[model samples]
Target: MSWMSVDIGENRWLSVSYYCLRQGVSSGFRMRNWELQGCNDGLSWQMLCKHERDLSFGEQAHGVAGWAVENATAYRHFRILQTGKNSDAVHTGVLACAGIELYGALTLACCGRCAALVEIDGRALGSAAMLEGARAGEGVRGCSRALRRSGGGTRAAAEKALEAKGRREQREREVR
Candidate 1:
């Protein structure tokens, strides 16, 4: 009846994991039967994984479920549909645990362009030329290396800015 949907940004994930609320015999509200579905348009859904009614997490502490989408087709939209509830929760809806962690490698890659220029390891790296010089998919690490390539002057400036910002924060804290 109820479902939790996810938009995998502009990239696709090789696999996904779901973390539930609780587990064990007392898990009346815990999701028992569910289906992991995928769709590119969000209108038509295709089944990815089907979990039948069972208390499989006998010793699994975290109530975690995961699977790799072996179809190899890149889907942008994904949903975990609760098909059936526990006998104790027969009158209720929703079958699987909701997503707590969203893992996407591309999300980090997408932000590398701007995040690198912002700061890294408490140092401020304000360099437009460095970012422009770097290629896509290099991510934060590549952008950082680009900053280093820009020479010691830029790196030194970033260090000073970080130090200055720290001093400013300490001063504000004392005032407060």
Candidate 2:
């Protein structure tokens, strides 16, 4: 049995709703029992979820080996512990994972009425500032049909918000 973990950095908390695991290209062994753990300080861990299915290479190759997290807990660190493998005696307990993907939404303010700006995959379809401007009784052109219909206020706030968001994303990318 073996275990592997990854740190998702600090300050930002992730609301992980689902996870995807892919088998390594050179490995034919499949994980039998696995547990996913989450932590805040990376010292104390909580069991997020566990699975005891056959994660065979053939099944994972078709992208059918993902599971939804029951509660969608927000955590800063995650660990994957493998306890068993579906292989012969010579290849027992060998763990080989090619890739793992976490899918979830980032906690962000949506101005109470701009839920439409967020897509089904937890991605914001538009800038937060534009949504906030629309909520603040300002007209944001081309942002949404509803906003365009209720046209009136100046575009100053929306523009400022978009600029700030752009700068923030740029800084975050640089940090990464």
- Candidate 1: segments with Cα more than 4 A from true spot: 11-26, 59-62, 100-176
TM-score of every model versus the real structure: 0.47, 0.55
> What is residue 103's positional error in candidate 1, in angstroms?
6.4
Q: Per-residue lDDT for 115 in model 2?
A: 35
Best-fitting candidate, scored by TM-score: 2
Candidate 1's TM-score reads: 0.47
Q: How much is 169 displaced in model 1, in angstroms?
A: 34
In model 2, the worst 10-residue window by lDDT is 144-153
**Candidate 1 residues 1-176, lDDT tens each?**
87878785553332333323334334455656777777878899888668777565544434654444445444568777778774354546734353434332121122244333544455445434333333232212334322321222334544554556567779999999
What TM-score should be assigned to candidate 2? 0.55
Q: Give Cα-based local distance difference scores for all models.
A: 0.50, 0.58
